[model samples]
Target chain A: MALLSIADALKSAIAEEMRRDPLVFCLGEDVDIPGGMGGAFTVTKGLGEEFGYERVLNTPISEIMLAGVCVGSAMMGMRPVADLQYGDFLFCMMDQLVNQAAKMCYMSGGKVHVPMVMRAPCGASNRGAQHAQSLEGFFTHVPGLKVICPSTAYDAKGLMKQAIRDDNPVLVFEHKLLYGGKRKEKDAISTIGEVPEEDYTIEFGKAAVRREGKDITIVANLLMNYKALEAAQILEQEGISCEVIDPRTLVPFDYETVVNSLKKTGRLMIVHEDNYNCGWGAQLGSWIAENQIFLLDAPIVRVATYDTPIPFSPVLENYVIPSKERIVEEARKLMKV
Target chain B: MSKLPEKERMLGMYRQMYLIRKYEERIYYLFLEGIMPGTIHQSTGQEACAVGMLYDLRKDDYMASTHRPAGHDLAKGVTLTSMMCEMFGKEDGCCRGKGGAMHTGDMEVGALVANAIVGGNMPISAGVALAFKMMKKDNVIVCFFGDGATNEGAFHESLNAAAIWKLPVIYVCENNLYSATTSIALTCNKPNPAADRAIAYDIPAEVVDGNDVLKVNEAATRAIARARTGEGPTVIELKTYRHGGHSRNDACQYRPKEEEKAWFDRDPVKNFRSYLLSQKLVAEEELQTIEKSIESDVDQAVEYAQNAPFPQIESALTDVYWEGK
Candidate 1:
């Protein structure tokens, strides 16, 4: 096992996938430019040198083209991993992602398949509203696409390789704060973990119990997973045990683990960076309400970013986004029930 | 100077064009009688554009089409039964009744399920071309769109990428001169909406009489050859007109009588019939025999679709995510 950052883990996964399959290639703005950043967050750094320009392509700053090209190429039996500079840029290719890529298979009566992956870096690191936003909530509602958020280096490499191999379109959402803090970006959460040197793949729709507890169950993803764990620690001092669950894949949600955990805890608190109304948490909460209403000790409590566009000011942004205190506070209230 | 393909090729093109015209005519009546499930964006007058552009494409070569896909799908070799069944929302349809008139295709025949959005197919077609280039295959994609699609960002973005990467795609825009209720002249600054915009992408462009199969085929051959040779993409604007409205509801009241009359006189199927006879390519009886076969074929297809069963409701849950290759 070697200590690897999320960026390094993703880059290694991409390099390995390309080596294994000649059909796999990477394309995005500044993705493969020599001496360039190798995508906005450097997840594809140095891949061009290994894969060559044919596989590691540099695209013009056209998000729609990036997404559409991936969909088209994938339909014709090519695996394209597209990189979106910022999660916000995904909105530019909304039609391609939501309509073209998602519906092609069903619309064609299973005659076609799009084996593609889109990497989106999300979360507020003071880049203001446009650049920073956990856009996963918007995509979870889209039926055809798979949404995965890996909070750990081990999960990052494994899930990325698995996503590349998946026959359908998958959106891999990486958090800005959890990009391993190696870059000069201010306040990036420095996270590095032991990733296996050998090839491996983690199954999707499985929840990772980050912190096991019996008092209350807390579910989170991306940066919020770490935040929830931190919140758990703070609550631990008060003898209020909390179980933190990191749902790696949002689309094929792992309800079994959450529901089982809810059975033991009898209380649920959903935490996320996406805004409050109609977020992914809301759907999960609604589903839990419909099916597991009797299992809940109290109504499902959601600790999410306030229902507003992310603000530019650091104070405003921090206030808008969910914090450790918010999670702890929400969990405390759920425990009161 | 005008040249002609061999008699066999000429008749084949004529047959396909006639098939498209007849198929659409049948659908128009079905729609009027409320026999069909949904609205249709029929390809009535633009038969030659589809036939000419797709005549040379192989089964491995793809065709990306738009809302008006019947003509392109038939030209690209999608079966009549599958298309008819799809229109009737039958389980045996190309898309298992999921894709109605606007989204019928058979990928095995290299006809993609049509895109209903105005300019949605542009980037997708470019991606298909990119795949061809990446795989080192000579197979090209003939992407079809309308004049209205020219103004979309997907068109500009996909064209730019195709130009830079030299993707093997022939972009055929059937310039039927209307985007829904709006005329192309009102929407676009240039008269040639698609061909004129090719200059911005630095790609080759051609404008041909869409009603004349020979002219459209000549231009298509050049562009298709260029794409197959890895020379890059070409944008060919075929000047044509839809004999009907933009969709099922519109009566095409927006188009002037003179404009409609002018395009109707140059009807592709009729003019091609004349050209074949004038050139002695086929006997008048031979042409009549082909038309008879097409009418009967369409009639049989309608009957087959009307009798076909609906897909099981639970089947809708499938194909949302393909489990395998």
Candidate 2:
């Protein structure tokens, strides 16, 4: 094992996949620009020199055109890892994703399968609301699309490979702060974890139980998984053994793991960076209340961001999004019941 | 203008136009009589624009169509039976009945199912051309759209990209004068937007009389040859008119009587048929036999669609996700 960041893990996955299949290529803004960060997160840096511009394509600032080209290419037997420089810019290509890419297979009645992956760097990082959003929930609701978010380096590499190989269109939501990307112009404190030296794959729809506990189970995704781990550490000292479950894939959700964990803890708390109302957390919370209500001894609490836009100020942003303190407090409250 | 088609080739153009006209007319009556389930955006009078361009295309070549896809789909060799079944929402439709009327197509035959959204297929067609070039194939894609589509951002962006890349694609604009109820004059200031805007992208552009199948066929042949030879994309504005309304319930009250009559006088099928007969290429008796055969074919399609089974309830969720895991 070697110390590797999320960006490096993704870059490695792209390289490995490109080597495996000649059809696999990446298309987006600044993806192949010499000396430019591989997109906004540096995941695609240096890919152009290795693969050349034809394979690692850098396109004009046309999200719709970029996505349309990817979708059209995928239909014609090419595997394209299309990216939106900023997750917020995804709105610009909503028609392409929602109307074209997602519905291509369904519209064609399974005759056509778009084997493409869309990678978007999402999360609040003191940028204004537009640059920051947990938009996976929006795509998760789309029927033909697959949504997956990987917080760790290992999962990022594995899930990305699966996405590239999968026949259907998959959307990989990577948190901006958790990328562990160091840019020439800017840098942030991030944990660059140890990635495996050998090849491995993390399956979709499997929940990784970070810390096992019997008192309460806390479920989260993306950066919230890191927050849950921190909250669990602090809660351990107070004798509150909080179990943390990181659901790698959101669309093909692993309900069995969630139900099994609920049976042990008898209480559940869902945490996410998305707004509280109608967020993916609500879907899980409602599922537990509907399907496994008998296993729950107390109510299912959800620690999510406020139903408001992410602010530019770090203080307000922290207040709006769910913090480690909020997860611990919610877990404690659920345990009391 | 000098690249005129032989008299025999011109007669073949008449057959294609005739086929699209008869197919669409049969579907329209079937839809009106409540035999077909979904709505239709018919291309009754715009047959030349569909048949003229698509007939010269190789089977491996591609075509991207607009919402009014029945004519284009038929011209591209999508069986009338499957098109009929699709209109009836049957399991045996071209798209397994999921695409309905607007999105009817068969990709195996090189047809990107018709896009319902205006200007939506523009960029997609360009990408398809890009793929063909990347694959080192001489195939070209003929992207068909309405007059109103030229005003969309996708049309401009896709055209510019195609021009720069020297992609093998033909932008066929069936300028039928109206976008739904809005006139083209109201949307675009230029009389010939497709040809006029081609100057901006530095791609050769032309305007052809869409009602005259021979004229349209000649223009399309030249354009396709240029693209095949890597001369880059060409924009052709086929000045035609839709004999029917945009959708099922539209009576086309916005069109004046004189304007409608003028277009009706120059029906593409009739004009081409007259040319074929005048040139003695096909006799009236032979033409009548062809019409009778097409009628029988359309009749069988309607019969098959009427007898076919509706998709099971489980089918709704079947193709949503490929893995279904």
Q: Which of the numbered candidates is closest to the native, going by highest DockQ?
A: 1
Name the lDDT value of residue B120 in candidate 1: 94
lDDT (C-alpha, whole model) for all candidates = 0.90, 0.86
Off by over 4 Å in 2: A184-189, B1-8
Cα lDDT of model 2 by residue, B1-325, tens digit: 2233676566566666777787788877877788667678899999888888888788889999989998888888888888888888889999898999999999978889889889888888887887887778899999999998999878888888888878899999999999899999998889897889988999999999998877888899899999999989999999999899989899999999999999999988887788778878788998898788777887788888889998886888877866632
Model 1, B171-263: lDDT tens digits are: 888998998889988989998999888998899999899889888888988987898888999999999989999888998888899989988
Clashes of each: 0, 0
Interface RMSD of 1: 0.6
Winner by lDDT: 1
DockQ of each: 0.88, 0.61
Per-model TM against the reference: 0.98, 0.96
State the TM-score, rounded to 2 decimals, of chain A in model 1.
0.98
